[model samples]
Target: MPNIFTQNLGETPRQALNWRLGYAILCFGLMGASRGIDEGLISGTVQQKAFISKYRLNDPLLSESERANLLGNITAMVQIGSIGGALLAFLITDKIGRLWATRQLCLIWIAGIIIFITSNGRIGQVYAGRFIAGLGIGQTAVVAPTYLAEISPRAIRGLCICAFSGSVYLGIMLSYFSSWGSALHISSHSQNQWIVPTSLHLMFAGIILLLSIGVHESPRFLASKGKKEEATATMSKIRNLPEDHPYVQTEMLDIFEQVEREKEATMGLGWIGPLKELFMTPSNRYRIMLGLMSQLLAQWSGANSITIYAPTFFAMLGTTGQSEKLFATAIFGVVKLVASLVCALFLVDMLGRKRALTYGIILQFLSMLYVAIYLAIVPEITEHFQPMGNAKRAGTAAIVAIYISGVGWALGWNSIQYLINAEIFPLRVRALGSSMVMCFHFANQYGNSKAVPSMLLETAMKPQGTFFFFAAVTLLGLIWMWFFLPETAGKSLEAMDEMFNLPWYVIGRKGAALTASAGHAENYMRDDVEKVIQHEVSHDEQVTSSEK
Candidate 1:
């Protein structure tokens, strides 16, 4: 419970605890549950593989590729559901507040799980539930960090949000453990291979349901809509800090100023008119382009391809020890969790979001390079392992490498991309903009899930070639990001609009007038972040800080 660093930072005691607990529950729990259910390789594929062997369907369906596509369809279905939830963000997010929205999402996820388990293990029901669960997952993806960014002390907001990212990768690793459990033939359904994992997911989803209700909503949402008393009450409860605290007043007043501007810009038409206006404006168009592209690029990185196919790829290399593979995957999860903490704890506020993203792209470049080598040049070595028993270690090593890519993922893949989306858009269109990106993101994800599985199944034999293709793509994405995407570090929506080429109607009083009167967003956000070693904020001294 004691640390050498934060031990004497001169910060309030409960303040740190407040941030950590909120993060552990809201961000961490969301990541753990959402991705936990998402790793189709965990329960679905293992189960399907088992069925193929059991029913003698393997002879026909084992190599059919359609079977895997079926599984990918299920994966895509969840994203499809997320697109729907994101689309609804404008109407629902602030109204319900971040905490409530996430809880509602958790409940939706639970319903899907219940349907999945109660249907006598029907694949159709499973897919249907996936669609529902995906919707919840998508909402959490948008809402969790949105709230974290809103309510967090500006000094450590990025770390809090990134924690959510760490939790997601951890969840994926957690899901993979289910497959390992199945492979170990432990519990009731290991005889069938995937049944244990399926039950395991339902159990986890149930736990998430219980956890969801305990979380508090974002105080920012409450204040933004003129719910002053409620906002104060929520902040008090969440921070366990009194309304008189300097930090609480700073947050509330900040929200008050932004909301005052936004209320003046309110167009009676609600989401419809403004949704059209956002894209119609030139500057908004540029912002939207970058936001959507960031998300699209994240998906194109083939993150899922590496994640879902790790076990199967390991198998092709002849890795037979189910237990070891699971442990390796778990280790990868721990790495991601630890790395995220490091970033949240020290690096984020120091290096800045733009730098963090650049760092992630660089990591992806290196990891994917290794992946390419294994795929293109390793075929001869794989053949040497021939049998599963003989090749298990090589296969497991391959999977471990795949998890290395997961480590980079914790850095920028999901959280960074989403952070950009969340940061760039003005409050007026935040949910809508995020939803639009999610929709596009899902559309892209659908293509990757479909294409990559088929690609790997056909080409995994060539170690270098397969990885080289992805590596090249990742490098290209890096270049594209550097040239096209502008830095968003610390600038609020209105200022970012100015940085882009946004028309006044989007972030200015003109945009405010288009909807209501007060500007819907602020322009500057200077976090009281410490320097690399430590820096103090002076009451009268001007401080310069960068943002994502």
Candidate 2:
């Protein structure tokens, strides 16, 4: 039902804005879907007995510890691919362009999907497929936010990126439901359950490839490439206005000015310039640290563990059967999807970045602590054991706590990191800097995914201890956020340098960096408008004198 172009010719500007948003969503939608497919694979893989059997995980020939190590490797390999993909995106995004890089990666994802569904229980094929698919995911992670930020109006930038983040949840929910349906209807011993889930990845990749066609390149990128007229034309088309329209002209000048400033700051270092620039100044250094720390906090807060290993987590909570655990995981996905929508729609811009994260971390800490304490008191459910009534009630409560913790993550950490990271750097270094931050995220994600399963199953902390570890990390994250991250809501991309350069306390205060930047931009725009008006008036006077 979605129209690719704006309907109703001669429509109001508001309708035009709607059309622009529709186009953005269409272009960015695949980024989220790819993420969902990437992260969602772990959920079904951990649950698929056929996948386990394919590798002889259940064979009496292997020791339990060996099987654990093998499963860990399988689950963690995707992160390895992600890390590789991040590096590749960094090298290519600036050189070739965001749209081109994204388009090529989507093709790779389709190829990976083909390999994945046809692997037919071959470990080598599956691992290769996972790594290739991860490359696509990594590229999307680094490019989507940067691309979205450049094209969006400042007033709605956060909202649009939040929607992009929400699509990841949508993909995750779709994955869960697909796997749940497959598991219910497909034979447990058949490979179809896992294959059906993977096929969905192919569907998403195809959509992304199709939607990517003819999407305009970032105007900032075009300007950086020294194609000023092209950049202006692209901006005009994207804004649905003439090149000289005050709004379009104002934005074009802002982009051009920022690009010049960034060139001077980096001394025109080109590809390697961003790395040096990142640490050359104290503010830039701090921003890099902020980006890295934010990602680390997002990972260590333990939401990902709950996401990738939900079925296993529910089993720890004493769910009676495989079906029950899968269904519970599906419910968790639903909660996460709803929470993501709330964040994208109501919180990110309205509550401001700092407060939303602080509140979300507090909620996360409480919920994690509740789950840990409740689990510590309740007995773990053994395969043949029947739990008492109160124990069953307590177990159900623990599951609810998991869902609440997921909500906390969605509200604060989920999309905010991407939005913040995307907003912090100038265009010259935006892609490289975002890739650097994404590398940290993917690296931590790899480590976490690899370690959490073993930590849950074999550690001194057991399942309860894992949550306790995450709660402590959440407390640390809260402290980091309060002192470091400033409010970026409603600020122009060109204003970020001013925003970050201000003292920590002054950064978010009312009518400080944010206000000054807006006022400064207005001054330039006002001058341009006045100049045009004067020129028109003078021309009319000359014509009147000539007629006389």
Best by TM-score: 2
My TM-score estimates for the predictions, one after another, are 0.79, 0.90
Candidate 2 C-alpha error for residue 256, in Å:
0.3
Q: lDDT of each structure? A: 0.59, 0.78
In the range 1-548, model 2's lDDT, one tens digit per residue, is 32312221112233236565568656875587777765766687667777777767677877756666777777777788888888889899988988898888888778877887788778788789888888878888888888888887665677778767888888888888788888899888888877888788888888878888858888888998889899999878887888877667667767877887788887857656788887787777767888999999999889888888888888888876777878888888899999988887677776778878877888889989988897788777788775778878877888888999988888888878889988888887788789989989999998988888678765446888999999999999988777677777666788777767766565545423455535233444335466544644675687699899
Lowest-lDDT window of 10 residues in candidate 2? 3-12
Model 2, CA-based lDDT: 0.78
lDDT of 2 at 138: 81
Model 1 lDDT-worst window of ten:
517-526
RMSD of each: 7.8, 5.5
